[model samples]
Target: MARMCAERVIELDYSCNGARIRLVRESGQDDARHREAVPAVAAPVVVQDRPPADDDAGAQSLPQIIEITAQMAGQFYITPAPGEPPFVTAGDEVAEGAPLYIMEVMKMLNRMEAEFACRIIAVLCENGAGVEIGTPLFRVERTDHA
Candidate 1:
């Protein structure tokens, strides 16, 4: 008996700063063909102006908010399993290496952990929502920074 092979196709489209980008991939395609389909361009570097330092007695320091993005496109989950409480919620302080969320890709669950201690300011994505690569999942303030 002989077995037959099936081809797979995947497409992703998104917009950034009014520029729309699209990606399409089909199984069994050569590297040259894939490269021709998508051209690479250098990303722009943004420089932000820093606030002037106050020499006076009443200087206010603001907490720096950081946005955590998805490393890969997948289904985002807050809990490890169905009916379970989330690993972390807004206003929760998470230590370094603590599990923050999970991404389900190709039937495999990938646990996302914090690289540094942080306070969860907000959960940006809904549980069980499909997210693309570079999608913002959470907004957190670094607690380890002084």
Candidate 2:
């Protein structure tokens, strides 16, 4: 995994077979005391194979997890401003079109919204940290809509 840490955002990137997977975390402060950034480098990966009989069961048992990716690369924010509560957190229920996070690109703050009703399972990026195109900001489980 390649970790990119900045004063504004935290990014975790993993690559396998030429495919890049990114995880983002929002930071609360610009200070380094917030969290240590992981260096961006190609990390060793291990692959495991499951027996044929387990394949079907595994596929069925796994819950569907949806990734919310960044539309453009820039800084990711969890709040509208400094010292404010984050827009969303893990386990928060969100409706379609709800504002989830914001990306600051070229001095513009672009709001990112949810595409469908879901519950946030995890937040991948840190606030004020830089991210790349298609970097995942959140992992959510789709919820049934009325």
Whose TM-score is greatest here?
A: 1
Query: Model 2: per-residue lDDT, tens digit, 1-146?
Result: 23345433366688999999876778465566755543332111111123223566675565556677766667889998999999999999998778888777667677767777879888989989898867777888767421
- Model 1 off-target regions past 4 Å? 1-60
Residues 64-135 of candidate 1 have per-residue lDDT tens digits of 577888777778999999999999999999998899888887677787788878898889899999998778
Provide the clashing-pair count of each candidate structure. 0, 15
Compared with the true structure, model 1 gives a TM-score of 0.61
Residue 113 lDDT in candidate 1: 81
Q: After superposition, how far is residue 119 of candidate 2 from its true place, in Å?
A: 0.3
Give the TM-score comparing model 2 with the true structure, all chains together: 0.56
Query: What is the TM-score of each predicted model, taking all chains together?
Result: 0.61, 0.56
- Each candidate: what lDDT? 0.72, 0.70
User: Any residue pairs clashing in model 1, and if so which?
Assistant: none
Give the runs in model 2 whose Cα sits over 4 Å from its true position: 1-62
Q: Cα deviation of 13 in candidate 2 (Å)?
A: 36
